[model samples]
Target chain A: MADIVTTANLQEPDAFYADLVAAHDGLSKDESDAYNARLILLMANQIGDHVILKKLLQEAQRTSRKA
Target chain B: MTKLFEAPLYPYKRCADQGAGKPVRHPVIVIGAGPVGLAMAIDLAQADIPVVVLDDNEKVSTGSRAICFSKRTLEILDRLGCGDEMVRKGVVWNAGRVFFGDRQVYDFNLLPEEGHKRPAFINLQQYYCELYLVERIRALQVAGKPVELRGGNKVVGLERRDDHTALTVRTMEGDYDLEADWLIACDGAGSPARRMLGLEFQGRVFEDNFLIADVIMKADFPTERWFWFDPPFNRDQSALLHKQPDGVWRIDLQLGWHIDKEEEKKPENVIPRLKQMLGEGVDFDLEWVSVYSFQCCRMEKFRHGRVIFAGDSAHQVSPFGARGANSGFQDVDNLGWKLKLILSGKAPETLIESYDFERERAADENILQSTRSTDFITPKSEISRIFRDAVLDLSEHHAFARPMVNSGRLSVPATYDGSPLNGPDASGLPARTRPGSPPVDAPINGTWLLDAMGHDFMLLGLGIEVPPLTELLGLPVKGITLSGEEIGPDLRTRYLGEAGEAVYLIRPDQHVAARWRKLDWTEITGALSVALGREGEI
Candidate 1:
């Protein structure tokens, strides 16, 4: 079984956040949600390891609206 | 000190045409002697076409209006024989600092590259631009070029004849009738000629006012554009500060949609606001003050029969991006060559449609850019302001957000990407100097490449052998060759790219008509025909 390395691993956190936000400019609520959905499918293709990909999806799903 | 702009540069004098009982048809008559009109006349006159300029006023424009001129404008003026003088009198600046609510965000340099002849932008008063152009006209007249400037000559009525445009000139003497084979209306924003012709502008109007205050001050502020959004002094409004020549600083503060124009413009109210923005200790004397609203609009078409419109007569934009006058210079540049070619019978009358096609595209580009910048500066809705503030907030910390912040998108010449005149753009050449784009200036041999071209068709061969062809297809096309040491990094990167050798067909207006990897005679003639508005005629 493979493990997902998820210990605050962004080299440029502020830069990434700004890019994420900037890409959503002029987009409505539904458009932004659809864009995120598309982004997920694209990212899944890059991390093609099945076990790590499953672990990442479970981790993201475990986080509810509260956190 | 008395200024050049204060005295009458081209005072009115009664002309033979005004009093000659029977109207004599001129080759070209330009209405309004403002920057656009003067430059238009000079261009036509340089092409050996006699042009007469008529104006309602005898003096240069009063205030420092349209102060920011781009490098493209300078290059165009250089073609008109007065670029060096304008650059000498103007304050050159390229860097701008942006602040969000009193905290400094990021600064930007407009041109970070070298080997270019002119700077990115210059803050010169509009009056000086008019003065320089009028001086050039005087010199052209001395040398006996067919150019005339008749000031205090107002054009009130315009009528289109079967083959020419007739006009009524109203002066102190009396009303006189005149005619023109080609009439150019550069009357200004409130163009009487456009009104007479029943043309109108179509675009959006922003609900905001700006208080422009030009003051003479000795301050420590560097000569850079400084813009603040929602600053403490102007709470919820934006303010801009720029330094000009001779210790003159221009300041503009945004006022909300609903406000009394008269009440806000009073000296007592204006000074206190200045004090708040620039601490109470700064000593400054007001030079010029005015209030204006921003509008981004243009006419449906620029060319109308024998009568054509240029500059403010055809379009007007918010003064945010300096697109107003810079684009006006471009209009003159694009129209002058086409008119000269048409008048000389080198190209057909259909070539005028290409002018309308290309410049109309350019005007759309300017309007689109100006409108975008205006929306970013002045948010129209609640959600818009929130998003703007959020971007400003993130811009300070993240380098990626810096490019997203919009103070103003400064003017650059438009490339007619899909223009009707653009011919075959061979692959593997530099994209910057592709077909329908203006030639990028680079140091070639000992002088600038732009200084060597223009005035006629040119075949530029870089790192390739060019046959000496004086005329091709009965049109004057001069071929010049450069190779070896002449193809430096700057020139190679701009013109050759990785192709190692390229030949370009340059229009009289210094735009690339077509480009190829090597000089092939068949391709050359085909491209030249297409460039002259004769498609597949070869």
Candidate 2:
């Protein structure tokens, strides 16, 4: 019964991304990939809903390139 | 092997039953002299019920199996009269630290609110637990209580009669037959009694091997539980470090789904893992090494005609949450008093059905939480693993995510919310001490509140005056009156809350059976009648 929030929840999203990438600076490709996995997990926790997360996953998959 | 397992404490001795040339019928026969079985025997003996305990092994547990004893279990032990010795010998701890990679994520304090007699948890080895229980039985036997422990008495065959169940127990000398008016199977997961009846133990077997290494070392690790997720020493797996008494540390390392168990168990393979965890320079000796894959499963119904199952024989959970033995102890706690009532002719036989009803709910609850913790600690899917790692990462900074970090949601007694035995509930009382919930501990008269509430159907008249009534419908009900002025603040908050006065009918196991805003004898007798499973008939 708790809901997942959407629509620009974070303030200064660009600033947050800058800090996130800076945290991953000087890391190898594998390390950066692991960081990205951790990032997805954090954001998914913030989302905190299974249906909303699946919807966002589909949306991101639609916009992204083929694997 | 640890030094504790070197000696057989209860070496085989020929019992009078073996020499009688025929089966001797005991009032109650309990299988397995482990903690649960011994506790069961002690409870019955304390109630003046004759009980006989049989076990295949003469010694206590080999290693530090089931090291953590929760406060709820300690309370049950207090009722059985050995909780003080366990607390004196056990390493009492209430704090735990968790880690992500190499960095500490967060630390927690299981402060347990306040006013409790026991701490949140204690880390005593299972051997000491059994030893204390056996010693209590010895004391009871000396006191002329008909509680006997027959070592090396293995139940090889079981047959249910119309009134009593017969058992063929194998000892070193020869096989002997015995009968029990009521039989309790407290054997471990692979219960021979369950097998004799061809009952099925149904549930999931987790796909992972864990190496449990108990090591001896003199280190000041602050007597707390430490858990790690994907540390450098063991990549992509979880690890747990728990302190046991007697300079022993229990280390569990996740070995993934695939490993040669024998090769992994070797000291050459295990010592390096320990070195990496407890820095290379630290000196330690391998006390014991074991590789095990646990299953979260249980029997369909605990009661099978006259042969009822308790402890690991009835149900089993993943060991991570400290639930396997904790819940098994709870099963004994739930069962002992009911058997006492039935055998004494104070309650109907249908009351035994309530045990199945309440304990099945407890088993399902433990199994659910245990399976969830297992999945979180050892995620089967990639996405779930990412979430677990994410929670660990977020827990370092965010307080909201910290509670979500499930490092074995430590064992707490289950509240039987919808139990059939539950009677009326007063509206204004606290939900924590509501009907069907265990009474929380408080402070009273320089002693503990739980110690004051002796094991019986007690009518706790808090901030009120209750009439002096001895027996309700042929069953005993003890009354304790604490006037509104004399009671402490902790008892008021736990039992009364905003209510002016409350009368709680507590079961022998200390679970609340009913409560009311005021004392009324009509309602009390109706509740006492229904609490013993005579609801519709009344």
Of the candidates shown, which would achieve the greatest TM-score relative to the real structure? 2
- Can you write out model 1's per-residue Cα lDDT over B323-376, one digit (the tens) per residue? 988988899999998899889998888888987988888888888887777777
Off by over 4 Å in 1: A1-67, B205-207, B536-538
* lDDT (10s digit) by residue, model 2, range B414-485: 898988899898888899998999768988778887887777888988877765558888776788788756
At residue B500, candidate 2 shows an lDDT of: 78
Indicate the DockQ of the complex predicted as candidate 1. 0.06
Best by DockQ: 2
lDDT of 2 at B109: 82
The residue-by-residue lDDT of candidate 1 on A1-67, one tens digit each, is: 6799878989999999999999999999856765664465446656868898989978888876766
- For candidate 1, give the lDDT: 0.85
Model 2 chain B lDDT-worst window of ten: B201-210
Clashing pairs in 2: none
Q: What TM-score does the predicted chain A of each candidate obtain versus native chain A?
A: 0.84, 0.73
